[model samples]
Target: MTLKLELEQYPFVDLSAKVAEIIEDRFAIVLKSKLTLACMYLDPRFQCALDENEKKIAKSYLVKLHERMEIKRLAKLDASPDTDSRSNESDNSNTRDENENLLEKMLQSKCNQAKNSHQKKILQLLNEFDFQSERTPTGIDIIEFWTNNAASRLELAKLAAVLFAIPAAEVICERDFSTLNFVYNKLRNKLNDESLQCIMFIKSNEEIFQMQ
Candidate 1:
């Protein structure tokens, strides 16, 4: 709306041109970012941020991530060889050849089982929209909420755990820059990158010890 108003009032102005360019760049970044969509769905603050259409968009992306994770998990399971009857391998060779059809059927059944389980999880997430209405009597600890309910809300909890781990601002990066400067001075220039990182992590989380 601001851009539309600016275009109508200052169609020939340089500021309007700059604004248009900036809006286009920012819009492209936001539209291309799956993180933005994931954040919108998982963040309690954004429970009411998106309209119905936007919620649908968020849901599609969230479900896509969930399905992708599930597929990878199932693929890993499928790739794992059965080892239970390894001791009788020589005798089992003939049996294995005969049971190829049964093995294929079993593999198909497991794949279907995995897909069904994933679908159930997605449905649970969809039905749990009311999770937004559950008041956080004390305060908002989004990560803790999901972590505590992980057992019951496995898929949604995993999604929340991942999304919550992503820092929402550049403040942590800026702080790390300052810490790097302090840690890698002229006298400490020989510190390897690994050691520097270790020092920085401790410095950043030092407050955790103070809490005790």
Candidate 2:
């Protein structure tokens, strides 16, 4: 369990996601992971042979796992005046305890390390432009674009959104690349701008252009 949790850490979030996609086992593993936590008291033998004591212990362990996951979920809610004050306080404590999520720490550390050069460059450029800190433009869009497009520090962020939205991307790319290569290769020496356009039309199976 500790190893699984550790494997889940850092600027390395997409590692787990990529592995999960590659193996197609993340979902199946999660389902069985919960079962394993409760496996201690769950005898493989028939229940008819077991007494009430063993059954009770097995049920208790399973319930405990659900309770742990549930408490963590409830902790993420915004504080509300209407919230049950007692449960809300308990959730807050449980939330803090569960927040040992090490991924955030690793990401921040990596970002800090990467920032040394980029930040220095930004400061130097600003100084060169005669823009003092007070006059410098600071906005969310500017920073977002700088980090995402310029520095490329946040490229994994773009990929994470894509990975979550589209599973099994590697397989799709693998299947299409062969067809693209065949189309391009067949046009080799015969290819000029006009004929290349025609080949692309043929490659994409646009029959109207082919007829023309």
Candidate 3:
């Protein structure tokens, strides 16, 4: 759109049409990625740009990702040694105040019910999310929005974290390789593997150390 406006203002500009065509081609290739499409659907600012069918496809992909994460979470919990200890501790608490025990049981039941309907919970989240509402401020941080505002919805928040952690481009990886070139030059070729890794770690996180 910006290029289109520029062309309107100065139609004789050399290679303007070629530049616009290249940009459009790159965008078309990006749109073919399901991950990119899903991210757009999740981002409130651009969600409205997707049509109904695209939205449905994005939602399905998100649900599948969430379900996979949910399975891994449950598997970890089941494998934990603490589970047996906690159950034994709960049995020892049977002699506590009757009303308090009843309340705990009720809360546990509610949590179990919530865990059983992960799909339903996701549907509810989609239905209830309204970025146009007064509660959502403009220029909000997407990661912070999911982590803080949706803290109560653990499954959704975890899914968002996993999705957003994926790098959109290979720039970071390329930067790392560039850094390695400087660190492991011909003069420093004798550096051992462990020493090289240590230097890289400090170099990569120098900004973080400075902030502290």
lDDT of each: 0.74, 0.45, 0.75
Which candidate has the top score in lDDT? 3
Candidate with the larger lDDT of 2 and 3 = 3
Which residue ranges in model 1 land beyond 4 Å of their true spot?
A: 1-33, 67-120, 130-139
lDDT of 2 by residue, 69-125 (tens): 434656767444565656677657766656645767886788677655544543333
Q: Give per-residue CA lDDT, model 3, range 1-212, as digits (tens).
A: 46655655655666876776676788788877778777876677677767777777777788778877877888988885766666777666766567678989998898678765877778667655533332434488888877785657676677678888888789978888999999999999999999999999988889999999
Least lDDT summed over 10 consecutive residues: which range in candidate 1?
129-138
RMSD of each predicted structure:
6.5, 27.9, 8.6
User: Model 2: runs farther than 4 Å from truth?
Assistant: 1-159, 165-169, 187-212
Put down candidate 1 lDDT per residue, 1-212, tens digits, no spaces.
35745665676888887787777777668755767866766666556655566666777777777888877887998897778767678887987887987989998999889777877769567657534555334366777777777898777888777677878779998998988898889999999989988898889889996897
How many angstroms is residue 49 displaced in model 3 relative to the true structure, after the best TM-score fit?
A: 0.9
Better-scoring candidate (lDDT), 1 or 2: 1
Estimate TM-scores for all models.
0.57, 0.19, 0.65
